[model samples]
Target: MRTVRNVHARVIEAPADRVGALLDRIASDDDPLFPAPVWPPMRFDRPLGVGAEGGHGPVRYRVTACTPGRSVRFDFAPPADGHHRLDVEPLGPGRCRLTHTLQERQGPGQALLWSLFVRPVHDTVVEELLDNAEHAATGRTAAPPTTRPPLVRLLHRLGQERPVAVPVPDGARLARTAFDRTDFSDAWRVPLDPGMPRDPRAWRDVLPFPVMASEGDELLLGQDARHLDFRASLLVGERDVTLSTVVRTHNRLGRLYFGAVRHVHPFMTRLVLRRTRRRLALAAPAAGSRHRRREAALG
Candidate 1:
């Protein structure tokens, strides 16, 4: 096994207490420091404190130590051996330094994976986190924003969330009754993140179909063609969004056309849904802004 250590530090033109307050909110709902939506938001099963259990995406860790606004350390879950930590230091009354360090013990395979894939993504995340820290504390980043390297961008795209096939939901009444006799029917779904739009109308533009009907949580869109008549449903639920398609054939020509199209339909549907989900997520308001809106509503 080999030991791997990585460190990132940024000097913020804010008091240590001010910057450290941002650190304390790391995995909270209103986190203003950890860059998210583009990257997965950091999450914990409970509140952000020692013993909290959760991690962003596939990375799993448990908080083993915490110093409130000053420092926190996470120990990687089983199958991975390492700990990563963040700390804040006072430089002066009006300035502070924030640092993140990651150390892990890796076998040959793990080390290779880290060097090629994990390192690039990890470094990018750390730098972006620091940039957010600077912004939240001083209203601007001291340095230019971190640009993701080509490999990192490619990896991120390839690793994006994928849609899963599901039975047509009963809640999609418009899609269910769109056609008198259905020849083909299918549905695909993807989870919605915290800040993602929840209204079905907001997702209507994902398909080129004309709006057929809409009710409650589902928007129905489709076109009647010479070969086949089809209906597409976009259902936005509390935690996920479902895209469903239904088709009806008029005759042999319709049957033949749909028979050929159905083969590629599932693949195309999943691809489109995944891409649109990511696009919407990236376009959502930042966590801090959303949190402020919620506070205003409550107030």
Candidate 2:
């Protein structure tokens, strides 16, 4: 059997004991390991020690040995013949490091699955976990990867589309209201809430370019920079909204930029949509009034 390995590590600002306490909390709750939609599959047949039964992700395994605030290892099954471990190493006083490794033996079929579907998702999620750990330790969010892979860059050059479905109350002015709350300029940099806008045209001053289109319940807004021709839209429905972004990479630079974000594109779309939904319902009346004023002006 060929042993395959995957590992992720991060330097934490917290002390060894504090980091270990965070790990213990994660083990007990599994919240950090598995966020919403990605459920943890640990079968705690016994306590946390050697021979205890549980599995991380899809690899079924039993505990090999566990040293509190230090290391915890698990042994896998036949197709996944190997082990996984999470270690907390003391870098020095007031500083520590965390490493999580998954080692398993698998055949051709398993390898294909891992390469195509599992690896990408796992990479993104693991990074998220590390970010969360850092946040828990220091109350600061970790910076994520700034670029995508080679293939993803090529795909970006050709073009790519991402759509997120977000549920919200349906109203006549929903589309405009949705746009009223959008600001993605610095979203890639830091965390900020950009909700429905009071004036769709207001974005013209904030963004580098002019307004693209602001229709009834559908707004197309973005800038066509030298790197890429980007257009983001809010397609409002009766009870839900589909936030979609289309990128037409202009040249190699555009493709490279797209490639950099391709991995995180899906999650970022969902996140923005989720954020938009929170303010959509609350701003319905304000949006309706604005829509009526526009109609009156046109008449």
Write down the lDDT of every candidate, Cα atoms only: 0.87, 0.54
C-alpha positional error of residue 42 in candidate 1 after TM-score superposition, expressed in Å:
2.2
How far out, in Å, is residue 36 in model 1? 2.0
Itemize residue pairs with steric clashes in candidate 1. Answer: none
Residue-wise C-alpha lDDT for candidate 2, range 1-299, written one tens digit per residue? 45678999989888989767666644342233322122222445666777888665455778888888688887876656678788999999998888888777778887887787666655655665566566666655457532335653343323212233333323323323434333221221111111234343422232244447777665566676787766655544432345555566667898788888877876766555544433342333221133234446789
Q: Using lDDT as the measure, which candidate wins?
A: 1
Show the lowest summed lDDT stretch of 10 residues, model 1: 286-295
Clash count for candidate 2 is 8
Task: Please give the distance, in angstroms, between residue 73's alpha carbon in candidate 2 and its true position after superposition.
Answer: 0.8
